[model samples]
Target: MAKKLIAESAAAPESFEQAMAELAQLVTQMEAGQLPLEASVAAYARGSELVRYCAAQLEKVESQVKVLEGDMLKPFAADGAGEGMQ
Candidate 1:
């Protein structure tokens, strides 16, 4: 089973895509450096939250893959593969 990755995705757009989008926006804000110290701190906090969300999602998928293919998962690799190539 693929574990229905879509279930949580629809409920929380905050899945990987949304988290990465927010993280990118946060990076732009930090790079601009126009915000005040307090604002910067706030941005950093929000970014950290997104980081945690992304990490947790990755962990969940990792666990699912493990359950799906135990030892076989380790042998599968896509070291240089690009998106939409498959």
Candidate 2:
């Protein structure tokens, strides 16, 4: 069962949202503290892999955005204040 869980999660999804949803589910189940020790371990491992996958996806997008912006990446501000802001 653990192997199967790991195998299923090993396949990358077409979208980051899908991976995040699945990762959230795994986290919920693991946090519930109802799974056997082996299953918990498997879930944790899958979660770790999902995290790495998500990070890679984000990094790719960030790189693309930077290229589109001519590498002039600006810091994001929450108070409506930053570079290029009036």
Best by lDDT: 2
lDDT of each: 0.67, 0.82
Q: Please, what are the lDDT tens digits per residue for candidate 1 over residues 37-84?
A: 766776777777778889999999988988888635764347655657
**Model 2 agreement with the true structure over 1-86: per-residue lDDT tens digits:** 54566567778767889889989988888888877888888888888888898999999999999999899787678566675856
Name the lDDT of candidate 1. Answer: 0.67
- Clash pairs of candidate 1? none
Candidate 2: 10-residue stretch with minimal lDDT = 1-10
Error of 2 at 10 (Å): 3.6
Tell me the TM-score of model 2: 0.76
